[model samples]
Target: AQSVTQLDSQVPVFEEAPVELRCNYSSSVSVYLFWYVQYPNQGLQLLLKYLSGSTLVKSINGFEAEFNKSQTSFHLRKPSVHISDTAEYFCAVRGSGGSNYKLTFGKGTLLTVNP
Candidate 1:
């Protein structure tokens, strides 16, 4: 069984502060890790992914995560968050290879950035 787990369902922070979102997974086989951000009813945008060969991966929007093999985790972090960063974040995983790219999403972590 492959599954993605986001430990926190909500994260609140003031503008300019740093934040870290926790994620973990358990799989009997290899899997691909991904982080997606959703703004309201819009589709999820790929924040970052850890496919292979590299443990550390980063996103264009100043977020990064490290893939730990032993712990089975990929935690997201940002140094200085903004008010514009307020959105719902989801952690997902897909089975390696093949066309079965079905992404199992977490419950979602709502990042509320207050001014």
Candidate 2:
């Protein structure tokens, strides 16, 4: 079994400021990690993921996350944020291999970009 935990429920940052949304997970087995973003009035979108290979993954919109095995963390970061970047961010994890559709998601962290 796996579980995810987002350290902050809300993150308020001025436009263009650097920000980081912390996420952590726990599991007895290897897992695939992901980050999902939800804009207002829209469904969640796949922001970035860490399936294998490099421990770092980046989104097209300048968001990036690094999978740290020792720390069991996959924290999202942006050097500079925009107004459009404001949204709810969710961290998720799924057990590797098999037909397991069981994915664990965090409560989510709402990013509010202020002017």
Clashes of each: 0, 0
- lDDT of candidate 1 over 1-115, digit per residue (tens): 6888899999999999999999999877789999999998898899999899989999888999999999999999999999989999999988897776777988889999999
Stretches off by above 4 angstroms in model 2 are: none
Candidate 1: 10-residue stretch with minimal lDDT: 97-106
Q: Could you give me the TM-score of model 2 versus the true structure?
A: 0.97
Top TM-score prediction, candidate number: 2
Q: Where does candidate 1 stray beyond 4 Å?
A: none
lDDT for each candidate structure:
0.91, 0.96
Per-residue lDDT of 1-115 in model 2, one digit per residue for the tens? Answer: 7899999999999999999999999998889999999999999999999999999999998999999999999999999999999999999999998876698899999999999
Please, what is the TM-score per model?
A: 0.94, 0.97
TM-score of 1: 0.94
